[model samples]
Target: MPPPEPGDVINYIYLFAHEAAAGRDEGVKERPVLVIASDAMGVAVVPITTKGEARSSRSDRIPDPVARAMGLPRAGESHVVVNDVNDFDWRGHDVIDLKTGSFLYGRCPPTYFQKIVRAVQASAALITDRR
Candidate 1:
């Protein structure tokens, strides 16, 4: 598979803030993650969650139409938690394929992606760089 690019959404075993704080190296669940940036060092991604209460003040909601366009599961509302990002190798073992036999759900629209980027820049969230 080709290297992941910004805007790509993929299922991954994303380590949550609480988990990492507790000294856990592995995430308990596999969920969707938005690729925010990538380079020779690794990739930076933010977790997407359907649980509204889990979202931080520095987050962006994915519109219903945009979520559908991105092929996200029709579960419910989704939000990208900009306050919590994870950095790991580009081809981390935590990355997983969807049921459809692919590692990607779809790409986030450029416009929406820009909004996310802006949020991230304004956020003081601590990045969990595990590279």
Candidate 2:
């Protein structure tokens, strides 16, 4: 499958700890990520976690309705870790099935997706000011 577009919610294998240590990421299970960009090389994404209490200034909570519309599991609340965005090579990674947890792509409504974009834009503005 092709890489998901920006604002798309996709299931991916995100081994963040490994990526930090070994300059590579290898995951054993599928995880949720919000695609920020997609190119021939791969996708730029930010990890989304279901741990609601983990929210901070760097993250934005995903509305429940939007989460369900995106086909995310009926887990607890979810949030996009906007500050931890990274680029992943599309060597063998892409979208995944939302229902059966199979390999396919999934997407959310544009209205809610805009919320994430605004959050990221705000974060980026702060970074620019800091620099």
Write down the RMSD of all candidates, one decimal each: 1.7, 5.5
Local distance difference test, each candidate = 0.83, 0.62
Clashes of 1: 0
Number of the predicted model whose lDDT against the real structure is largest: 1
Those runs of model 1 whose alpha carbons end farther than 4 Å from true positions after fitting are: 55-57
User: On residues 12-89, what C-alpha lDDT tens digit does candidate 2 reach at each position?
Assistant: 765443344545445545778777777776776766777642323367677787777776665357777665555666
Best by TM-score: 1
**Which residue pairs in model 2 clash with each other?**
95-104, 96-104, 97-102, 97-104
Tens digit of per-residue lDDT, candidate 1, span 12-120: 9999776788899999889888999988658899888887536233566789888876667853588888888899986889999888898898889899999998888
- Which regions in candidate 2 have their CA more than 4 angstroms from the true location? 17-29, 53-57, 93-101, 124-131
The 10-residue segment of model 1 with minimum total lDDT is: 52-61
